[model samples]
Target: MLLFSPVLSLLALSVVGQQFTNPVLWEDLADTDVIRVNDTYYLTSSTMHYSPGAPILRSYDLVNWEYISHAVPRLDWGSKYDLTGGQRAYVEGIWASTFNYRKSSRTYYWLGCIRGSNTQIYTAPAAEGPWSRKGTISNCYYDAGLLVDPDTDIMYVAYGNTQLSVAQLSSDGLSQARTQNVFNSPSNIGTLEGSRFYKRNGNYYIFVTKPANGQYVLKASSPWGPYTSKQLLFNIQTPIAGGGIPHQGGLVETQNGVWYYMAFVDSYPGGRIPVLAPITWDSDGFPVIQTVNGGWGASYPYPLPKRVLESPVGTDTFNSTSLSHHWEWNHNPEISKFSVGAGLKLETVTVTNDLYVARNTVSRRILGPASTATIVLDYSGMKQGDRAGLALLRDQSAWIGIKNDSGTFRVIMVNGVAMNSNWSTRSTGSEVSATTVTGGKIWLRASADIRPGSGRQGRFSYSTDGKTFTTFGNALVMNNDWHFFMGYRFAVFNYATTSLGGEVIVEEFTLTAA
Candidate 1:
């Protein structure tokens, strides 16, 4: 059996031939929506405030997935999206999105919403995307769901917070023709959002997220619904994982007619991680999640898909002409601030007391239940008061970096602990530990042990020769909470708190299962 780390989520299971496990993706991939084109399955997830918004992943089998591309490389709506002038867009940017492939035109359509703007649609000839902005939907559609009717080919968007609304779109999916309220969840059912619409077996099915409860479905004979609703999955809790419910995801069927539901749990400090479950439909055609021995459980020994693939993230040599799909900027990265040709060159843009607001911090999703990340830093170009290193970045994060002070270079480990606030308003105080280095070239690493019994801690280390590593600072207690609304990531950052001339070249970066 190929078992994952039991400490990663609620529980872990092994893959045996056609049998696989739960939480199919152990990384931070939230607000997931899935679509099948031919034999290929494509998934798009929310990357709030992270540049390269709406990452699209591909899979031949439902069990294995790989990062393929991003729908939007950068959110250029405003300067705040770029972290310009001390402004930030944390827990904001492209939220939940709807992805579809139209057979009529051989075009791919993606629609998502950002604050201060209308719902935007991006189109491409293929999923890899040289995607162009088609246009925008007039009203704000939070957690929106888009559907291109298979018969009429008319596009429809279903979105709302407490009140659910469906709006008709033009054939091009650019303009809104008409809109109306579909269904409003009563006050007792928490907040209802994250709607994904579909047409199956000649019936219109709309799946919505009901927080604190699991996901529910609304079935209608027509697109504008006089709908009937039912709870699809009520028991989504896992005793071993301890994370909350698996809500806010979409459904997809395999080539051989096997059904599965993709959703996420609020695994804090880790971000919203994706979880998968085998689904079955009853005679009435409503989908149901398979349970273990008539109870809600995390991992189950279900038959896996026949195909398998390697993970999407791994080591990078900084040799690619463009940034890898595995990487995302903290915000819209300043193109001039970083280059990939001669190693990853990160030029300091501005001096900031907070690394959370620093621009051009390239990051990749951290693997779980445990993983180790390392980065080789060439600090020859580092200037005075410049700090460049590797970090586990989130609202409450830590780093091991080389800081150039005067003419002396030192290895410093600092922990950014935020006090009682979200990412944007969090008051962070940096605690510089007692460690020093006098070398111009150094390698930094962070190991995260997020398993249950380990107390979910991350520790940092540094090596001057890249052979012998020395531990630094105290263990950072990982905050597994929704306060940050995202997962922790392995990040490479360079910034000057004094001036903006300092820079660092990252020669290599690697992430390995620990």
Candidate 2:
């Protein structure tokens, strides 16, 4: 079914030409890396234990980027990822990574550390792929940068914090040949990390970050270096109001040799968001963020001259045989638990009172700085003790939905449900109103204010009919903490407090600018 969509108009504006804006991706796409292979630019971001970890996004013109595929189809790290025996991997899986395209072998490499250790790797021939797990490297290189030296076909990784280390990888790219400390920071510099390795003009450059507020360049003749360091960007004013400086991402050279730095700003609630800056090299071969009054510009000319495509979330009838690529499960999903045909039918995979541990809770990023998602939920299938609905999902979450309270149907608004760092959850998260509803079909909508600043809140509303909605409960504060790195998302979830067979049918979901 072809539906009139606002996203189509946004995509069409690019025909006249599009501008590269700050917070280019307005959601939680953090700890990013960008690489250009031929005419296309591919990006990778830290997925933080979410299934389909380490996402791959592509931009034909660098003005509009769309989802390609995830390097990790599932977080197959261990049983902890499966919620087996109540074990959880929250904030544990994939962290900062280095993504590269090697021309000689015609492969794309995605390498990162899980939970500050346990280095893992994945590779594919194309950005969208049949990916192969290249296996874990025995050495733990935190926040790694992979460089396959084109001159000699040797692979090297620049990793670590404060004192940076470079390790030469084996011919097969799975193990380390040798390791050496290449660069170190002074006691006062604070936390320095986020390394991206490169070779340009017969010299090597490793871009490193002081993660929270600064970025620096380390230069040397060899991968394992007695390297010299220079400050690149430090505490620069952010174009985003009340946001931190842009730091910790990758630098890419366009097809025409123009350079650009794609970094993320630690804007809480909305999470760490990607911001692009045009780059130029100094006479001494140091990279510079082409600044607007010594601060990154809010908008600039498009980074590349290519086709324009912006695939933002839009109206969905839930009629597709398969769900769109924009959707991702909370963790490694049991595939048999959910199906998309006439509508998205999510079968509860586990008997859980907490939504955080509930399996097959499907989600997608919210459109910012303000937007709303209205979903039609067919609640006829809910059994006793079943709760299903729409949520502003995070470690701290809120939901508005239907609860089959001992087989008595009710529409409720629940807020303050929080998950502990240890994976346990508690519900200060409560149903404020337990009003009985007349039907199994209902509509729920969440309106969010995600602009960068302190203390943003999300509001929820519900409708017995599709057109009219009643603002339900008190707006809940959103999680801006860096520890809850995935940020807030719109989730469609169904879980049972007593049994595992109950389900929910999401007939349609429409996302619109608020």
**Candidate of highest TM-score:** 2
Q: For each candidate, give its TM-score against the true structure.
A: 0.92, 0.95
lDDT of 2 by residue, 272-378 (tens): 88999989988998888899887989988776553556446567877877766677778788889888878889887878778888888888787778789889999
lDDT against true structure, model 1: 0.79
Q: Model 2: how large is the Cα RMSD against the reference?
A: 2.2
Off by over 4 Å in 1: 1-17, 187-190, 296-305, 417-428, 434-436, 451-455
lDDT of each: 0.79, 0.82
What is candidate 2's TM-score against the reference?
0.95
lDDT of 2: 0.82
* Candidate 2 segments whose C-alpha is farther than 4 A from its true place: 1-18, 421-423
